[model samples]
Target chain A: MKRHQNLLMALAVVVLVALPLWMVHKPAPGPDGKEAEIFAGADSQAEGLIGRIDPGYRPWVKPLMEPPSGEIETLLFALQAALGAGFIGYWYGSASTRARLQREQETTTSC
Target chain B: MHIMEGFLPAKHCIAWGIASAPFVAYGLRTVTKRVREYPEQRMLIGVAAAFTFVLSALKMPSVTGSCSHPTGTGLGAILFGPAAMAPIGAVVLLFQAILLAHGGLTTLGANIFSMAIVGPFAAAAIYRLVRAARLPFGVAVFLAATLGDLLTYVTTSVQLALAFPDPVGGFWASFTKFATVFAVTQVPLAISEGFLTVIVCNALARLNPRELQEMRVATGSEQEVQA
Candidate 1:
């Protein structure tokens, strides 16, 4: 059963990964003969739409800090994610150890 | 989805903020009550929030020329009911806005409505529905996470449509365009998130059955965890 489950998971991962690549690479240009962008996020789309609607509109607020470059911004985000994941992993490990120790103590007392 | 700063007009921003206030308030009350009742839950909630932050921060390639990330709301909603995710999600969004420049203060409410409220509630509902139907544990987790991710984008489309109706075709046309554009990337993202969430849940169940049990009790889902 475990093996079957693992196989299913592997299939899902491959399909999920491949679907995006195919969508990105295989599509012919539209009527305008312009290739579709492969990665525009929702926020940018919304911003672009708003700009088209009202060219005069300005963002009322600005970010306090901007990264030196796009790559730096991505690097910072990755760093934060790694730190957060590490913290959660550590907490879960320690919490499990504590629970095991408590269970052992209770068993000994019962004896 | 993190709606960019100033993408929303002031009134729309305020309106969304107003709409989200009650949910955040109620979430805060539930979280405090849970923490007071079970001190251990404090750490659990923190860890869950951290997990959300990390998962959301990991960007994946998408079809729209912009990267997309998983909301991570489904796992939290499954562990701690939908309502409780509001405040946790708010914190994560706020941090992203300030620290990462990913989201913005003005658009925080709109972003929260999509990622926090709508996504989490949908996930929690689907999870309960699937589990109640006697589905397998993996199926329930996959559906909840996938649907949660998809619905977040759907809600974002609605928000964008409301704010920017099409000049000729009106709101419906605008919504269709936004949804279609986003679906290019979102569909695959949803599937990937589902598989990733299932793996994470399985790992948690194996390494910390006690924690999983606590989550079941806290979420009021007393069903036995399948091996």
Candidate 2:
């Protein structure tokens, strides 16, 4: 189970990193939708099934309401993602800092 | 705060995913180190995992009657401390979004930024201030927990506003509704967080005072100087 979890997490990381790169670097649409066009059908169909089956699917709609466009929207999305990752990094860093400080206090006080 | 799909543009979610990656990396390191250090690391993992699972399940209705659950930052902060809580939170949020589909994959960054990042810092800062001011831990914990909850909503409101067709009014209207509606349920939860923080901290402070002391030292937070 742990191995599977670790693998899944690794996959999430790859997709996250690769997607942004692909979006930015991928040739500006030669035809219908980007590579996402292929997967989007499966994705939406899944959403459709869930919404149809689950009475409590209303909350999931808000984040998927609109597709982004142009440079500005893309920039905003990137900024938001960067901020999210940074915030998480900062959080754990701060926690460790606190723990270290606690350990130091114990040392100084006892001495 | 749940970041629903369609709340932001799809591009935004993609960006959020990118932004959240480094944090996950840092979190992975933290998880490894901590797991290695503690003798009962496996147990610790189990406990954190279980509580997070249960907390996510305990959804309540808002004025929108859209259901929301506790951030559980207070709970994480109590057991793991705020720094440690970050990774735990990131992992939990990711799991919730991906596995449960409770939150959107695209909005993972904003959702995590709101819940994991904001929540514990709110508690930690307040607690430290209380120590500096020589107020009881009890008071500090309460204020921290309350503000933590408040901050989560405020952040959520901003994200929702930014995503809509009409950003400003959309944000204000949603903010007003959620901020108001969540308070009733959130109040008790905040208090519970505070109460739990103090209780748990007290237990830690008593048991193996040296290790707890080492924690503070390693973290570089000053001892509570009675003012």
Candidate 3:
């Protein structure tokens, strides 16, 4: 039961990620007369509402350093994920090794 | 819940910065104290920060037909207390602001307030409440994380609404519009975060029982540590 629960949890996460992409209805065309982009980031969508609400408002400050292009932005985001994944990998590896060695030590002492 | 770099006016940005400063300061002190007192748990702390880093970078599709990412702060808030997540979250938001330009420097305070401070506090509170109610361990973590994610977006909606109230209907109407945009898109992603946090916590309980104990996360039945 415990094992199945774990599997079910994993399955739920997978379903959450895939469900929208799999079952979404296409939104109406955007202002540019092209079909609205699917799965666009909500942040930009909020920015759009800001524009509609107050057309005169303009962003006063710009990013000190932005990725030069979309690809670079993706690359940086990928880099962030990579850095994080690396730490998590190190954590699991060390923790597992520590647990295994401790278990072995306990058995040896008991014997 | 990134409000973009310059989307918030100068006054609003400063206001949020002021509002968030105290929390971040206290949190930074907590992080330092943790490191100083329990050197063994440094790696676990790193893992917590990394979890947020990875989770926030991934823009998952939501049932609302938009994409949004989870703050991944709930687990840390649950494990280390809400205060510690503030500094960790600040670091991650700063990274995104400067490098990815996903969130901007101007709006960093508001973003940090919403994603880091408010979300973590809410998560930790809910975690305590649910645990006090004697819910299952998994249920507590799941609720803490899912609600934390949702509340972060709700805070963002509130911030945006405050800054740009509708000419016709004022703050409430603007809040409704912004909440519809952000919070709705966050629902599925929040659920995914809840499950992911539970999976991670279960693994930690199994493999690093001592660490969890030291962190005080393995209480009672939650202490299903490898025997």
Best by TM-score: 3
For model 3, the stretches where C-alpha displacement exceeds 4 angstroms are A28-33, B222-227
TM-score of chain B of 2: 0.73
When sorted by lDDT, best at the front, the candidate numbers are 3, 1, 2
Residue by residue across B7-112, what tens digits does model 1's lDDT show?
7789999999998889999999999998887786676677668778887887676655566778888887887889999999999898888877878888889888
lDDT-wise, the better of 1 and 2 is: 1
In candidate 3, residue A18 scores what lDDT?
90
Give the better candidate number (1 or 2) by DockQ. Answer: 1
Q: List the DockQ of the predictions in order.
A: 0.48, 0.04, 0.84
**Cand. 1 Cα-lDDT:** 0.79
State the RMSD for candidate 2. Answer: 16.8
List TM-scores for all candidates, in order. Answer: 0.84, 0.55, 0.96
| Residue lDDT tens for model 1, A1-111 | 654675688688678666666676645789999986655566676677777755777888887767779888888888879877988888868866876797799899999
For model 3, what is the alpha-carbon lDDT of residue B71?
A: 91
Off by over 4 Å in 2: A1-111, B36-50, B60-67, B78-81, B165-174, B181-185, B206-208, B217-227
Residue-by-residue lDDT tens digits, candidate 2, B73-120:
654454455666667677777655554444666677877777776676
lDDT of 3 by residue, B1-227 (tens): 99998999999999999999999999999999999999988888898999999999999998888889999999999989999999999999999998887889889999999999999999999999999998887899999999999999999999999999999999999999999999999988999999989988877877767877888775454434544
